[model samples]
Target: MAAALAAAAAAAAHHHRLSSSSPAARTRVVHHHHRRRRSSSLSFSAPASSHGCPRGARALRRAAAGDGGGNGSGGVSTGTVDPAAASSPSSSLEELYRSCATWTWRGMRVNYLVRGEGPPLLLVHGFGASVGHWRRNIGVLSESYTVYAIDLLGFGASDKPPGFSYTMETWAELILDFLDEVVRRPTVLVGNSVGSLACVIAAADSSRDLVRGLVLLNCSGGMNNKAIVDDWRIKLLLPLLWLIDFLLKQRRIASALFERVKDRSNLKDILLSVYGNKDAVDDELVEIIRGPADGEGALDAFVSTVTGPPGPSPIALMPAVAARSPVLVLWGDRDPFTPIDGPVGRYFSALPSELPNVTLHMLEGVGHCPHDDRPDLVHAKLLPWLDTLPSTTALTPVSSPAA
Candidate 1:
């Protein structure tokens, strides 16, 4: 049985490479820029597939509070709707709050939000984060793109079914499935931390070319990645991880540990530790990370994901993905979880030098979640790069239904 499983995994990896191979020469560029912006050295070449995509340049007004409503069958609007526009920040929040909807995925309730209208851009949050974590960026991004943010199953308001073994690959599959069943179109996937790695896997292994482009923010290493690292610290850390894994299997112990971890104060401290801009760790952010912990199966999901076998590593998947779609990597230099100086960060820092289809940007003073930690700086870089993408196809606005 073990041998059969290994063979299947090997076959899938080989298929991923074969499916993603393209004859076009890849273009590579790397920029290590800061928030305030300074002149930086650059070397660049155009991607093999660069072409004009018909899209309006005018900024879209945020959908008025009472103007939009979802049908609840994926809550996607088909026809063009010019809902009244509001310019205030409060209205932006109102539009976002009113846009909430839920989708049933594999007998599980998955919470999601869709806003604005244009080509689809899916925003995936990191571990323990949900749709609300993208609160600061989604409204602004939705102006130019139809933004879709989902609470991955087991996180946020999504159903967290107990005893369901969680793996990075499982989340990746969920992402691809969401693209197929919910979005129903190719999309540019923007993900942070482990979410970024999931997007990488989805883009690499997708059978239908569902992913158009990838924007990764400080992508993380797999949970079991320590097994492959040659460093002495990893050698020591592996045993500790294994010990924790064993302890977490005890329901009582897992529940107790989870309780401490999810405490409001503890969550805030954890957030502050990783956020480069400490001020970004506000009460709302803390609540966003804390709200779902009370769910019935949250503890099981947390334990399972923490102890699960490492799925495909981004380093192994990026080559296949870059061959088929352009990749934009944004790393937060101040991140502690996947420290910029760590093996994973170093690998991404150097990836663009080898793969022409990959572009790397190191965001100085930014922590793990660059999108939330410093949305302004993130937008400054992200918006321009998005305009230059070769794969843009317009889709009708999918107005979010009233909450």
Candidate 2:
């Protein structure tokens, strides 16, 4: 009876020890499996550290291995890791915001935005427009090239140095200076409306060798003599109309002038769309439009360009550019400023037919600034053409030239 009692007590004690060991061992295996899954999910290749063991198991193992450093603490302390250091590339793009810089050129502070990365692409906005006009194309173009959109002198964020003559030649020189100093490279010069004229002049000048190609969008340089004569009549009336425009600049007068057309809705929408976001079309932008209306010098810049001497006359320069560089002319068929069927078309048609480097594309249902209205269409046509051009077209060691 004494022996039997002893054996029963031993069996009970062994069963108790087995029950406790099995649960702990099973918990440790589950814990290790969970850690492995987490590591795999994070793509972490780090070796499993001693801490990879279950909370109490690591301490138990350490104690069993005679390592006195590990106390009987049930909790496991893991070192902290930086989350930012493990962040993805998309997070870097989210941190990017549009930035601007001012550089001195011909004693004028010209403001420009340099965004994205790749080959250089210089964008010039037209009259009554700021760099804001290029908002639609900026992101798309930035994908393949570093896009620099600038506010021409006296426009947008640029310092309008009071009394500075805003002639096309002067503007052209300013752009050339900008190209030399800010866009140090042979850049693809893309210009719209009056800006196109400036780009043409710059390209015509032998000094602007950095201009690799020309993309003129709904250009105004090809103005016919009859249009010039008609515009002169309006300029003669500017002195009398000046007072009315000044008083009505902020009021409905500016909007009324544009609203007189049959396509008022489209025109109004286009004007508002240039702001990109409606919030940007605040009192400040309204003031920019009114500045030229109130100032006599600004009025002269507009009048002189249309009726005065410095207006865009492509006859002299177009022939020269046609001989040298690849000139891609894009005209909006429905352009109100420079109609395809009007004097502008006649001027372009008069160009030598056999010119090998010149190409003309007529965009349907687009207006004065196709880059703003139909950027995807413009980009679709542009990218393919650019691909065909020699890879050496981009200037080497790209840097802005001295103004």
In model 2, state the lDDT of residue 97: 22
Q: Please provide, for model 2 over 92-145, each residue's C-alpha lDDT reduced to its tens digit, 9 standing for 90 to 100.
A: 111122356666654446667676665677899887566666755665566556
Query: What residue pairs are clashing in model 2?
Result: 180-401, 181-401, 184-399, 184-400
What TM-score against the true fold does each predicted structure earn? 0.75, 0.59
Each prediction's Cα lDDT score? Answer: 0.66, 0.51
lDDT of 1 by residue, 107-197 (tens): 5677777767778899998777888888778767776677888889889877787667777777787787777666766899999887898
The worst-scoring run of ten residues by lDDT in candidate 1 lies at 70-79
In TM-score terms, candidate 1 sits at 0.75
Query: Looking at candidate 2, what is the lDDT of residue 317?
Result: 79
Model 2 residue 155 CA deviation in Å: 0.6
As a TM-score, model 2 comes out at 0.59
Cα shift from native, residue 227, model 1 (Å): 5.9
Pick out the ten consecutive residues of candidate 2 with the lowest summed lDDT. Answer: 32-41
- Give per-model CA RMSD: 17.8, 33.0
Q: Model 1, stretches more than 4 Å misplaced?
A: 1-97, 223-228, 394-403
